[model samples]
Target: MIDPDLPLDEQNARLRAILGALMDRAERGQLPSRPMGQLSDVVALEQQVRARTRDLAEALDKLRVTNARLSQAERDAVGARNTLADALEAMGEGFAMFDARDRLTLWNSQFCAALPDIRDQLGTGLPFQDYVRMVSESAAIDLSGPAERDAWAAQRLQSHRRRNVNFVVPLVQDNWLQVSEQRMNSGGTAVIQTDVTAMVRTERLEREKLLDEQAQMVRATLDHIDQAVLIFDAKARLAGWNRRLREIFAPPSALLASGTPFTQLLNDLMRRRLLGRGNIRQVLTDWVNGPASRPPLGLDLVQEDGTELHLSAQAMPDRGFVISFTDLTRERRAIAEMHRMNETLEARVQARTVELEAARDAAERANASKSRFVASASHDLLQPLNAAKLFLASLAAMDNAPAQSRLIGRVQSAFASVEDILAALLDLSKFDIGAARARVDTVPLGPLFARLRDEFQPMADRRGLQLRVMPCAASVRSDPVYLKRILQNLVSNALRYTERGRVLLGARRHGSALRLEVWDTGPGIPPDKQTEIFREFTRLNPSGEAGMGLGLAIVEQACALLGHGLDLRSEPGRGTVFSVTLPQASAGPHAAPPLPDSDQTAGLLSDMLVLVIENDATSRRAIMGMLEDWGASPIEAASLTEAEVQIADLGLAPDVILADHQLDDGATGLQAIAALRAAHGDIPALLVTADHGPALAEQAERAGVLVMTKPLALRRLRRVLQQVPQLRAGQGNSAPGARRGDHSYWLRAGD
Candidate 1:
């Protein structure tokens, strides 16, 4: 057998010798007794042994190559370690590396040089947290003081686990280190520490110099200001003061020095009486010992010599307070002198005011008397005017020659002028005496516009002017009578002044009001004369015009009474626009306007009986005559008593009763109507009066009696008489023995 552990050459020689013997034995066939199979077996066994030896030789060769490569790698590793050690030693900054397990793997000599006490504790295989703990516990290092050591260690370890971090740490002897940490791809942390002590010292020196300069500037500014100033530290000790404080208080040098307690200084001032008497000392003491945060305090101090001083104290962000004192002596003295002088002047003015008040009272009384006279005169004038108007209307209704007709027409025109002047005077008096009242209603503009067009169309045709009134869809909140009169005066003024151009009456919607504007294309009023035109008896052209220039005056007063806003816009060569603004109202049924004036009174009052009770003889006769001309059977009486006698004794149940408001025996037409309705039935009655007061109208409305202000319109009178039976029927009342007829309805007076 070959020995496997023997040298390769020796083993090969042994194998060769064994193989040679076996082969010779097999080739000689010496032993005839041995079988050929056994000989073949020996030969095969030698072949297997040789194959095993060859495989062993190849394995030895491959092992030798692997051992040579491993030896070379080990040598390279030793050299790289030496190079890393040299590089770390040569670096300017201290460097350290922690492995993935957070164990200190490598560090340079300068890593803990600033803190030599911890140098021995830092080594390979030491945990990163333990290294940080040793450094934080080191006596040589100052982590902003000893109190922050434990916190610094915690922050250091936390930063070591982050990707990148940078911070500065201070050491004893004013040294500082800038530490930077970076994370490696192998999940290890690398820390680099740089000494920044020189740069930190340089910046600190510059900062101290700047602070010195600022302190000097503050000291200079405090000394120059007029107010005395003192600054206290957070501990309430005297920290700073200005020259003015020393001069004002005049305290001893020792008491005013720095480091003195605020209480000590305050007690010295109080003892010397330099500070004002009162609670000033106690207040200062409590404020000094109070909480760090306090509200600002201010007080005025009057000195013994009458010198005034204002003291103000406010707290700062550092829990200190700054106190200031300002002298107010000169200003106080000047104010006192001015107050004395004002008292003297006020005494003189009081005497004068008493005299002026007496004069004003007397003037007001005189004005009131004038208003009464004007009112009485207008009422008395209207009575006779009403008679003449009625009589003239009756005469005009009869057939006459053309020459007589023209003269009657002139007379009617003159009467119309007188009527307008009287009406304006009455309205002016009502406003002057404060007797006008606005009965506001939801007055629709549709019917009002229709009436205005009918009244002005003839005048417009005669003057060859276009008088256009736009259709209105809005309603307004105002007195129906006063509002219509205001618009009428405005329209009349516009047409009269406009020679050959058109006049426009329209309504424009403003926010909550409707602006009723009367626009005219005529010779406009000048800016200066515009105000003058609204004054009574003032006209631009008084020659050819029939008006007494009271149109605009009446409009102004009516608008004022109704509480409507009025505005006028006019230029010399351009047109004019007069706008009246009234509040808009919701849609509602309004009292219908008066029927259009017509001469056709033929069948309206034919065979209709009307009882006329008027006090004025001429007025009663004229009204009775006019009623007769309208084909109505009229009965005349002088008073309500006479009419009652006619109805009771004569058994005259008239279709309608027309009575005067101011009747004989202090009996108003309203009372008369009430008496007749009680005795007879709810007879349709009309009250005619020259007094257009709101009291009479309200009384008439309650009594269900219609009121008509004189001088009355004849056409209106005839129309009203025609519809009296219908009005009576609508009331569900008819006089006994009265005729019933189907007649068109007419709106009652004061509707």
Candidate 2:
């Protein structure tokens, strides 16, 4: 009666319902006896029922097939589970399951491999905690203490539940295993372990190497960095410090051992102003919040042991400040020494500057005094010379007298002395102004020698000394004027110094130079005084003669200007030799002609009319007498006015005109000569001046007149007169008596 299409639960309910209905019908006596026709129908119905039963059996067969399929699925699932178990057992990661009691339930091959010594006990099912203790006690691993082990175990348990624990442990075997644990269920735990010994060893070595490298880098940085480094913890306790810090603060061995309080250390520094004007905590706080609020702290602190330290510190709010202490004793000492040395150097420089300033000031004052002296002396000396010249001119105009010659001679001598002094002073002034330059020219030595002989011959003869000039064939390029002066000074000096014996002037060739020498065989210069002789105002024998002692000084100066070398050789009581070396002239076979003898007397008593215009009557007479004696007609004029009157009124144009340079009317002889020449065209004139001024000579030369300086010599006058071209034969000496009776008689009568 059950529905064959229904599910098992529904079919069971339907079968139950159909059985109850059949029993009830049986109980109800609804039976039918087998009737002959009806019996056949009933049997048919039963057959139908049997057919339904067979259909039901076929349905049960389908259900049996489904059940068999389900059984096969279960078997496959079991096999897969076994395969998983095998796989996990063979894996490098140790797989295990454990109960809540921490008992090892299962372990993989990798776990046994990791702990080979404990491989045989794998199935023993030991507690994980017991295993940890055994390993720790055996020294195979260090878990520190029970507390540490408990912490680790608890962490492992928690990590297992979360499936996050993956850690390794080294065992007796030369490998390590990664142990990962997970809680499988409420009753047990699962663990997976892998052999990661190579990785672990490599990682450990890398870690160690990294640590070592970091240490080395730290040491290198500390050794090379300019700033010192120190580290402290939040407790203000020293944690780490570099070698430089150790050297600065304390010895390496004792640094950590010393339990020195940071506050006490800071107090020492603060007392010394190392931490500025604040407590250590306040300084540290300021540094942390804002370092700009306070000034930098630098201090020198002396320790109890007498060690000095320079301390500097900076704060790191969270961590303690890094304090750097540097030993600065040596540096301080060196700085002190440097400061002292600088002071000494500055003092020396100041002293030297003061000395140099003083020296410069002194030099300036001396120069100023010298200039004043020269100006004053020159003015005073020139005024007297002008007056003497004027008086001499007036005397020369007088009539002739018996004592006139003697009077004129005395005046002449006096004038010579004044002239010499003036000349020397002028030469000295030229040197002072740096105008005493030399004009180098090729001078015929012969003529120079001749002139020197002519000038100094009579002088030497009067002194009873032989004056000779040695013959020289050389022509030298030198300043003729300077050479003449030098030689004159040497000769005059020789004559003055010498009592007897001859004086020789000579020249010789040495190498490419000409050596002009003056030798005197008389009392010589002492060897000690030879060097002094060339100095200005240095006279070896001042008592011997009247001299300014500038002669040899002038020689030296002239020689220097000419670029010549001067040498002096002398032996006391023997002789003195003064030599000047000059550059040689061009070499050649040709030489200059010999100079004419100055002593040769030529053309006496020529037809020469000599006009003598002189302001000094004495000079005019002397000159007239000398000209008449030489057989020449002479005319005399006392002044330019007289000369003009004589020329205009007398209508007398003389062949030669001679004029005195200094006139009574403040007129120069140059003016007198100009007036005379205006009357007589192109007439020869001679300028005679008692003035030793070079200006007078220059003026006369510019006027084309010959110049003769006073104390005029008669010989020089004769020589000058002979140069005149207008004198006719037998006209030179017209009448000595007529000449003497005229100007000479007046000159004598006036005297």
Candidate 3:
């Protein structure tokens, strides 16, 4: 065995030397011989020694490699610690971090720089709560009182536990610090402090500059406006005023400064009576002394020198108010002048109105006289014309030369034209005087169209023009006579103007009316002349073709009277359409068939007894002669007395009495017919009169008398005579003395 104190290298060297010596001796066999057991012990001991040597060598190699790796690891740890320290020192913001257990872990040198009083106390192992407590208590933090400091510490701790938090704090040295905390992924907290003092100072400077500029601008604006302005603060002290206020009030300069009490200025103005004797003083005093949120107030004052001042006060949002004054002297003077002018104008208008009234009265008298003259002239003119027409009719009935007959026919044509002119004039006169009124009737368009077609078809053929009356089954609500006249005028105008092409008379159904249209392919009227055509005697063509140019004038007047809508459309080379719109009406009972003509019904009056009375001798003779011609037995007389005697001597009760409306001695046909009817028991009397006024017609209708205007056509006469028999049949003709009375002496004597 080797000694334990020897070095391992030396012991190994010695063992190797001894082993060599033993091996050499054993191989040479130069030793004493021994037993077999003893030889085996020696080999075993040698093998043991070799095995221990191999084990020792392997352990030594492993120890050397282990020492190399441990050395490198130590160097690496030192380098990493140095790098972390440098990084924390280079950071701009003060930074600190805490571990998962709420113990301080990392910090930069800048940390707690604001709280220098507590900076020395910071360390790696410090708990976050203790760190916040130290920061709150530091004199560097701008916090007051011990209790406030405790509350601040609690808030800081609470903020550090949240996911993310940020706040700003003012430092004692007029500096600002923005602190921000962030949660670490490893369940720690990070805090950052940013110095924001520069930014805060910039914002404050800008705000102060803006307020100064606004004050100057307000001062300039208040001075420029026309109204005097005064501003008071919430404490009822004068806050602002303009130059105009001093000029208007003329108050002492001492009272005009800012902060002057409002009551001082008010009292000065009132004592001097510069504010007039108005309630402006009381109103202003009450509003100023009342609630801050007062209603708006206003007052008007007039000074002794006739100066008008309007004072108005309005509240501001901050419980302040602005009062203003405006001079109203010029405005008041202008209003007074306007009122005076209006009064003068009203008086002038009243005087002019009186003059106009007198003129209107004079015009009315003249118009009345004209109407009377027209009536009188028509009656006097038609009487002789009636007699002459009768004589002409008698001449035509006799056998005469064809030439003589032609002459007579020509004379009759001239007479017919005269009659038409007269009739048109009378119609126009009635329209002028507003005497005509619409008599609405359910006039069937079918019959009216048919009659128009028949009347105009012959003329159309003579003119070589086609006239088309479109079939219409509709009826319309309108005055039958005026509606007929309107359509007649439209159709006649169309036919007259059109040299060729067709004239169409048709109706279209509108919502509640029928638009009766008359269309013609005519030389279309110019647009400018269309309105003129509706004026009297305004003929665009002026061809002198049978018309005096009053047709359209009458149409316009009649349409106005009837309230019919008339529209005309035409193009220069195209066609013309005149449309009349009237309300649609339900179909009414068909009218009675027209009375038969004299030729067809003349025999029906054979052996009919008729009495004729007249004031004009020629009219009486002519009417009596026509009665005989119509196959009637006739008694003729000139007045009521003459008719009674003739009736008594004739010994025949009259079947029909024909009497004139105007008789000699102011007696009328109505009165004569009444006397005769009292004697003859309601005899059917026909009044043949030249007067066609509404009064006479109404009177005759009430007396159960039929009226026919003067210069009547012979054919119409025969028709009326035929109707007399019908009337007698309806009234039942009386025998002589059937119901006699004192007025029936002639009838009593005959009986």
Candidate 4:
């Protein structure tokens, strides 16, 4: 087959080459098969052999690359182990890692140093028990005793066998360590021993600093507080005391400082007698055992040394208590003084009230007495004057010659002056004593001015001056009688003093008031004496026949009573003008009733029957004479009994009755009137009184009798006569009675 056709040497060489090729193939991991018989074929086989050799070389190169990678992996493993050991050494906690057998496999220098005495002895492969045993014997693990060390090691060893364990361990030199162990999945353990000495010391220092700050703050605040303060701890130790307490108690500084026992402080106080120790000790005991918050306890005590103290104590929520001491000596003394002053003032006020009551009673009695005296005097004096006035009028009625009538008129004028002076004095006294209560009424200025004009026109004619009264339709709010009196006085004064020129009585509208003015062209009041003219008894022209200066004063008082304003304007050598501002009112039928005209004598007086009841004998005679002059039949009685007899037995049915207000035998003129009316009929009557007071007016009004004051002209009687109707004795409509003195039916003031 080696190609028989070739030489045997070639066949043999071919076979040896084939064997060499097979050996090369086997060396290069190539399998050899049977060869082909040809040299070129052998060359092809050589080419195939070269290709297999190249593939084998590529596989060898890949295997060499894998070997280099394995070497690099081994180097990396060594580097990683170094890095792990360095990390473990750099850790804050001691590191000790054990294998599943509980023998130490890895550890750092810190782990060995954690047991300072056994540092050289600690290493890998040490059982956890031996390590704990070594640590237990060192000065680092200073347990309570050998028994405690053994127990702690036993308990730690038991914990080490578990999957996890964590605990703190104390060491020598105040050092502390927290030991923790975490079991791995391979049954190995990682133990961490953290040296927590710095953390524990830092926390303790911070706590001490906070406590110091709080204590300082408490002390500073308590020092500034006004009251003395003392604080006790939960153990009843004197934990805090302010500067004020030290000053107040005067105790030794050391005894008052913090950590001082409360019992000791109380004992010191008891020795010093600053407190009743019994009370303080009882309260302290209560505070220590009591439940929760309650009202603070308080005590006020006056010490033996004159120091007054107000003490209060409150129990803290979680601790002992706080106590305060306040001095109250000043407050106590002030309260005592105030009480004393109140007592004194009460006594004084009681005394003053008593005195005031006595004085008021005396004043009331005096006023009543004065009123009685004034009324009595006025009545007694007017009786004589009334008699004289009527007698003079009877003389004048005789148709005497001019000279005789002139002398009679002069005497009458003097009598009139006396009457006016008395009237002025009475009015002044009433005003001064506040006895004249005004009876206010609506006064129509028309009627009022008419009266004033009629009243002063004669005086104006006598003085050779014209009197012109301006007509006013305006009505006013005033007491008509008082208002008329005021104007009468003013006009009389004006006409008396005014010797020439005209005297004008007029009214003008002034705002809501009517200014009733009296203007005269006589000598005006001097500027200096204008205000003086209104005072009592200040006569400006005593020789010239001016009044006793009471006219304007009466004007002033009357204006005051009506609350009207009076103003006077004057210039020396000129005329004076007096204006009264009268409050204007609604004008209608509300004006005051007009007074009867004394000048008119219209009734038939001769046929009329009249009875005269006068208290004074002279007044009765005078009244009877005036009625006789008027030609009226008059019956006379001086007392109530006499008047009663004249009315009953005499069967007198008088057309008119003239009664005096103050009658004899404790009977008033009104009583006489009432008695006569009972026997006779409802007869018209007139009450004549010396005083025009509220009592007499009210009595007259109640009796349905007209009122007239004393010392009046006979013309007033004539005017009264006109009011009575003619009733003759033969008419016989009623019971017949005695008639007055024989007289005609009518008579004027001059008749």
Task: Pull out the clashing pairs in model 4.
Answer: 604-745, 605-745, 606-745, 631-743, 631-744, 633-739, 633-740, 634-739, 634-740, 634-741
Q: State each model's CA lDDT, in order.
A: 0.77, 0.62, 0.75, 0.71
Cα lDDT tens digits, model 2, 447-517, are: 67877887799878877999999977577888667788899999889887777899999999889888999
Over all chains combined, what TM-score does candidate 1 have?
Answer: 0.50
| Candidate topping lDDT | 1
> What is the Å distance of residue 688 in model 1 from its true position?
1.3
How far is 627's C-alpha from truth in model 1 (Å)?
Answer: 0.3
**TM of each candidate vs. truth:** 0.50, 0.40, 0.47, 0.46
Candidate 1 residue lDDT tens string, 1-751: 7677987767777777777887787778876787677677777868865775686688778889889889998999999999999999999789999999988999999887888888888878998778887888888776455668888898788777679987878778878888898999999988899999999788556435533543564576578667999899888888889999888888889977778888888788778776689999888778767766555677899878777999877676467777899988877886785566557766666665676578679779877877777788777667767877787777687544467599878778867876887788788888889998888767778778877888888878877889999998778888878888998898888887777879999999999789999998877888878788899867674312436678899899888888889899987767899999999987564344445454654676788878898888868888988888777888888877788788776676888889998887787887777888888887888889887888877777666566788999766666667666666666633332222111112353222
The TM-score ranking, best first, is 1, 3, 4, 2
Q: Tell me the spans in candidate 1 whose CA falls farther than 4 Å from its real position.
A: 1-360, 541-543, 590-601, 648-652, 732-751
Which pairs clash inside model 3? Answer: none
lDDT of 1: 0.77
Please give the TM-score that candidate 2 achieves against the real structure.
0.40
Please report the TM-score between candidate 4 and the true structure: 0.46
